[model samples]
Target chain A: MSAVTYETEALTGRDFPERAREELRDSQLRGNIRKATTTIRAKTAEVTGELPDWQDLRRAGQAIKREAMRDLARNLEALEANVSRAGGKVHWARDAAEARWIITNLAQAAGAEMVIKVKSMTTDEIGLNPALAAAGIRPIETDLADMIVQLGHDTPSHILVPAIHKNRAEIREIFMRAMGLDHLGDQPTELTAAARRYLRERFLSAEVAISGGNFGIADTGTICVLESEGNGRMCLSLPRVLITLLGIEKVLPRFEDLEVFLQLLPRASTGERMNPYTNLWTGVREGDGPQEFHLVLLDNGRSRILADPVARETLHCIRCSRCLNVCPVYERTGGHAYNSMYQGPIGAILTPQLRGFAEAGSLPYASTLCGACFEACPVRINIPQILIHLRGEVVREKQATLGGRLGAENLAMQGALAMFEYPALMGLAQRLGRVGQKAVERDGRIDWLPPGLSGWTASRDMPALPPQSFRAWWRSRRGRP
Target chain B: MSGAREAILGSVRRATERMPTGVVELPGYRRALGLDPAALLDRFAERLKDYDVTVLRVPEAQIATTASARIAERGIRTLLIPPEFPEAWRPSGPTLVPDSGQGARELNEIGGVMAGCCVGIAESGTIVLDAGPGQGRRALTLLPDYFLCVVLARQVVGLLPEAMPRLRPAIDAGRPLTFVSGPSATADIELNRVRGVHGPRTLDVILAG
Candidate 1:
């Protein structure tokens, strides 16, 4: 029932800058990203402004998440006890491979040939579909966006709308080619109709179902999933056997903590006060839902993140993707530029910590330190500060590998320190620098520079040695010299 | 799996070694609207109407007549109802489909489902069904295209905080619950909203006194 080969996301050899350069060239992708983000950004501002106590809500959200992290062990124990008392089986997985093995065994135990799924970012992060496919169990995506992505044989680009990179025409073509249909127009409603017809039978007949929890309450051992389309209800209700995979960080201390996240997530993600469907189930019920329930609690590098006091807040993300909508870099390059399942500012900080700092060094530098992500964050994560901390960690690691010192960077810092130590030497160098730039100056700016320093000049011109340096002009004006 | 659980829990315990096992004060949205029953009903109806869910308010005596009219007007040929539903509330127009542990395919063939809600949230316009009494099983209300729910005015709660305590019994009993705010809708394709996906495409509320 279990196999060693699970299809997780493969790492591209290319870094963010390389992928961003390619994404930037596609004007159609750029237009799609910009239009979608602009609409969501405006709508979020309007809806979030209606509540006068939004700041209080944000603060409360942060506090509750902090409390959960502070006492995760106790809450987890309570959750396990409650789930056991309610007759649901619990399994723990240390990484993605172990998680896949557990879920595959469950599906096989139930004699399931195919499984239905709701839209869950955790499953995407662990690459659950490909694994299930490899084990000869077909996993069908029931969400509208996920169905589109699965049919198109593409990866998800955005968190909320995974197929945001594709327009309606592309979706129609995917439906026609994949589902073997014709005469479909480019209207979203028509394409949705096609999906509804295609997936309805599967939803009714699928023997097993898999989902990722939005919030897990420790006290009641209840799992909450919020979704707009009724696919979530279908997946949660119709199947005979159910399996849910959740990250360890999704636990809340109490069942009532849902009010805060329920307020924060929908408004931030889709600009709605509440989504259409919010499903909560404690465990296996006799005649109602699935007869058997299994929960797989996945670590997958979260404990390492929890150990870091400086970077721990990255775990508080509710996967809202609000930061993505407000991000200029994400707006221009789109989610595909990030080269990971998680994208945008939240992804920039979270991906590195989850995968480890050494493997994802370039992710920290992906941001412009614009502070918009922090401002838009529902939990007030202070993402910029975390990025800076990760940057320092990367720099320190690199320096250690370079025999305790970086070559050019070390020499430049030493030179600056030496200059700052002597006022006369600094003044003399400033004068010499003014004279030194004459060879490269073109219309008072240097558009090209020497080797090793050409990266700055490649993007924009550098002001050629500002006439005299501010200190020199200040001294001259005051006649202090 | 046992080894994995121990390893995971060990790592978590080590990571949170500095945490104290005491009562931690957490900031939360503690505001609960203290509205009277009538005001709460009005607010709940308004909120439900805001989501494009039709809300019809009538006296308790008129519930049977109104439900019959609604079933006829909506052209519902077969309506599904739980075994515990009030005999008086059954409409005279449509053929009532009994809750006989029907499968998804059978439920899908039904025209509509009418159930009694356990609670109504005023702030979010939500109707919660706990699979108790006349609510039937989860699949009955989910597979059908149209859902008509009856919510007594007294069952309306002002906020989520006020509602959760009332829902504790169902939560503890591990009953399957559904929180339906409006008809099934999606903004997946280019963030444009299109209604009627997998769940019921139409939701009508009978706010009876």
Candidate 2:
């Protein structure tokens, strides 16, 4: 009944920083990014502004997800068992490769040539389209934004708003380029019309549809996909064979949990009190929706995640993308900077936890600790706390790989650790620092630093060491040891 | 409901037991919001505006005939209405399709009419649509181009959670349940708000006196 997609990523290791950096420096991208995110933020705020108890719903949302995580295994098993029992097939994947193999096999077995895909980050994470392309099955994104990204051959920049990196003008260009319109107008309505026209034929025609669930309810054995577009409907309904690739973590405990999320997600994502659409289905019906349903439950490192008790809750993310909208770094650099299927604060916390910082490379440092993501999060995930946790993992990973850190920083940390662990040694070290303070002192702070530490010192001045040891001060002030 | 659901259904049954029914009273949702009995209509009007649902406040006497004329005027056919759509409010020309069940009754074409269980959370512009007595079948609200919901002065609440207690009995009975906010829309197409995707394109609300 229970299926896992990713047991591990089997990454080539943390060695691809340079390749990712070049893609992050596009001026057109920066301008497009700023305009797109700001506008969505404003629109969501406007929509969510109409409701009260948003805060309560957010708290409720957080509680529900917490409950889901606490009982993930049971829920996932139930969901898988139910789908299987309902005459639907269930596929378990260990990672993207496994998932692609399972899906490609299914497609080939079904003799399908073209694929219509609903908006799914899991599919993107697994590189499903490219895999399908290589296998001679063309995968077309059905979600309007996803289709826009597909047509343009561009990686999605935002979580919910994938095309957020491209403005109306850029879209006009993408539309003209992809849809082959020579004189496409640069207005929102016009562009939207063109895109809608282009995709309408695909919607009514696509024989196979692939999707992701917002929540996979374990109890009723249901899959929930909350979207604003009717394209999900077409992808879901028109297709004779429907294949869904969902994360193992998307399962919830009960139907009632959906109530809390139904209220929480739209408000958090686009700031709407309630989403315009929420579709929940058990299994394939006699004459409704897709006749044949296949659910590929992906672990893709989730079991590895489950093994790590400290970071597994990162699995409970609802993909609301609310955190991204409010993220300061995500706003400036945009999604491409994070360089993963996920972006922004939730991505910062969840990605590093799922993929690990060693292979993820520098993503752990991609946060300002502003706590906006935590505040905006519907599930109330303390993103900063997780970011800090991942940073610790990153440091541990660095130390393990570097083998005792031949660098001075490791020597300092080891020396400090030894001193801190032993009180008398700590006192001597602090006293020594008090005497050494004059070397780096400038107005009670260290303004200049070395190369490795320059990134830190660029935005921060290290506070001057205490003039007198803290133990000495505490002893004097307390008149005791 | 027949196959391969033993474990999942058992788990569902177990989970429902944990939902802790009667946690809060339903009727109290209206009272807790603290509205004077007479001022209920004002609260609903405020909520209508707050939820971004357009409201057409008209006297009960003028409701059906006026509403029917409005729909006809707009040149829309295929009206999907809840089971309890008032006999007086039936419009002319449009075929009133009711309770076609899930998936079979997709709100793709035509428009719909539903009864609002309660309207609250003015800041979020949300309406709680429980497929209970008057709210009609779930499809009545979902599968339509334009949705016209009738919110009587009495059936308005400030938040969805407040309606949970009142809605539980129906849920326990395995009755249909649907919670809606704003018109059916998606912003994914180039991040532009396009109304009437799968649900109603336009949602017009009627606050009947």
Candidate 3:
């Protein structure tokens, strides 16, 4: 059997802690993220609260996704057959490398010098832009936020709003520098108009366009792409050839399921009743949309994730990104700290699993276990539970190595277990801790700690140990009575 | 490539071997807003207005006059009209260009496009275009700066679920669908929404009975 290859480009060079430490220093990024998250959170609450059956809709979505994952192989085969029957070619990719190669070859075969792109996280996961650029095909991002990120040579920091880290002023600078404008205002109207003018010509002449699937119906061979701007429509309509890169897990059993998701997604993701446009095409239409269509089914470690029963629910995400807005850690540190295209609470669990624990093991520990992400999830994914589950997997993998068995953390945990087993030993340790903490104590809190224990105190203050242990206090009180 | 397909399917089968499988029933929640037909139309118009789209309610006979007035008001001179578009609703003054697989550049040069819709959802204030008789192709309404869609009162539904059954026939016929809730918009700049981007910036909907 050939070994499975996990996604590589989505992994980060540095661990989450190190990346977070650097991100915390940028007060401007912090301010921008806080404001954006706050605005989106309010909007989502207002719109979601309007639905009397919102909870029922979420539950139905969860059940449907669970069933889809359970019968994934059969559904995928069905999807392929239906798409082919409707005149669309279906390609299967085991991993990112294969997907990229297939897409690059297709673009080359079509003699495309430039290809327009709709905003897609799947393409970013496989690192498609660099592959296309290497093949000498210019890929133009037509989404306003994606264009801002591409023009500035920056990675996306948020799922819904890729340029969430940048305010209008920064966007203005990036647009002016990239578009070669002498003067550009920072107002959103001016910036959007500039993008429309810049991308209109590209859309008119592009031969090929690429997008990520929001949902692919297995029964009818329908592919859905939902967006706020008309960029998605332009790409889906104008291009002669349309290529959609869909994860294997994005398939739904029936077309009517859109009723549940269409209601949930827009409200949860962008806090709108409905986005400006949603494009759905089955395959090649004679004179309407793309004459040639290709659907690339990408596994890229999704099957490996599905193997584990506890963590498999991660596949149920609709990319609504409400979790990112509600998460305390994501709000304070921003998405750059997560070091993956899938950021915030979802990223913490998803990246580690998709890229393997060895490459992204530190991501599971990036959260505060706040439980906000679980409540905010549209499909009812138990994210905090999955975080704990992934953390166990990370620890178990580490313990398999000799270095991990004898590591400082393992020894400390063993020693603490022994101390807790004996009351006298526990008392002695508490007294010693009280004495040791006095040196770093300030205003009844430990503001600093020695190197081994400093990780906790770096971002927070630990309350000073009480004068007497709780056990001792209870004993003394009983004696006095 | 076939080997990759087999490998992926094999792994998925192995991964899900232990998981339980059964029929997952969809919820039985109410599909409609439970409003009268008049209220549904009012709700639809209100929702569209929230997105800053201009909405006009006209009698069936006055659709042409109202649409023509809207076109002249917006100063649209040249219009792209699908051949299947109802002759009764065709405006008088503008030079109507029939859709003949026009390139994007040519479509952009035209002032606006007018079409009929398949269904309208009041809950989301959305209209679905299924390349049906009068709707023409997807690009006809997409590239132009202005779009005027005529939605008969009978076409409006109370909710998304209600609209689904109406769209199934179009799906079975292999037609492409576009759902437009409003004009093109973006909130990418610090979550401040600015309408008008790649799609038509100005949207006028004639709600006729």
Error at A68, model 1, angstroms: 0.4
Q: Write the per-residue lDDT of candidate 2 for residues A399-451, one digit (tens) a residue.
A: 88566476666787888889879999988777776776677678889887667
> Which candidate leads in DockQ?
3
Over 4 Å off, model 2:
A1-56, A84-87, A402-404, A419-445, A450-459, A463-481, B1-54, B57-64, B77-90, B93-158, B162-180, B188-200, B205-209
How many Å off is the CA of B151 in candidate 3?
0.3
Residue A356, candidate 2: alpha-carbon lDDT: 66
Alpha-carbon lDDT, every model? 0.86, 0.67, 0.91
Model 2 lDDT per residue over B133-186, tens place? 556544445445567776665555554455556655654443433445567666
lDDT of 3 by residue, A18-130 (tens): 77889999999999999999999999999999999988889989988999999899999999998999999999999999999999999999999999999999998888998
Off by over 4 Å in 1: A1-13, A403-432, A441-446, A467-481, B19-23, B28-30, B34-39
Q: DockQ order of candidates, best first?
A: 3, 1, 2
Please say which candidate is ahead in DockQ: 1 or 3: 3
Docking class of 1: medium
What CA RMSD would you report for each candidate? 3.0, 6.5, 3.4
Between the candidate structures 2 and 3, which one is better when assessed by lDDT? 3
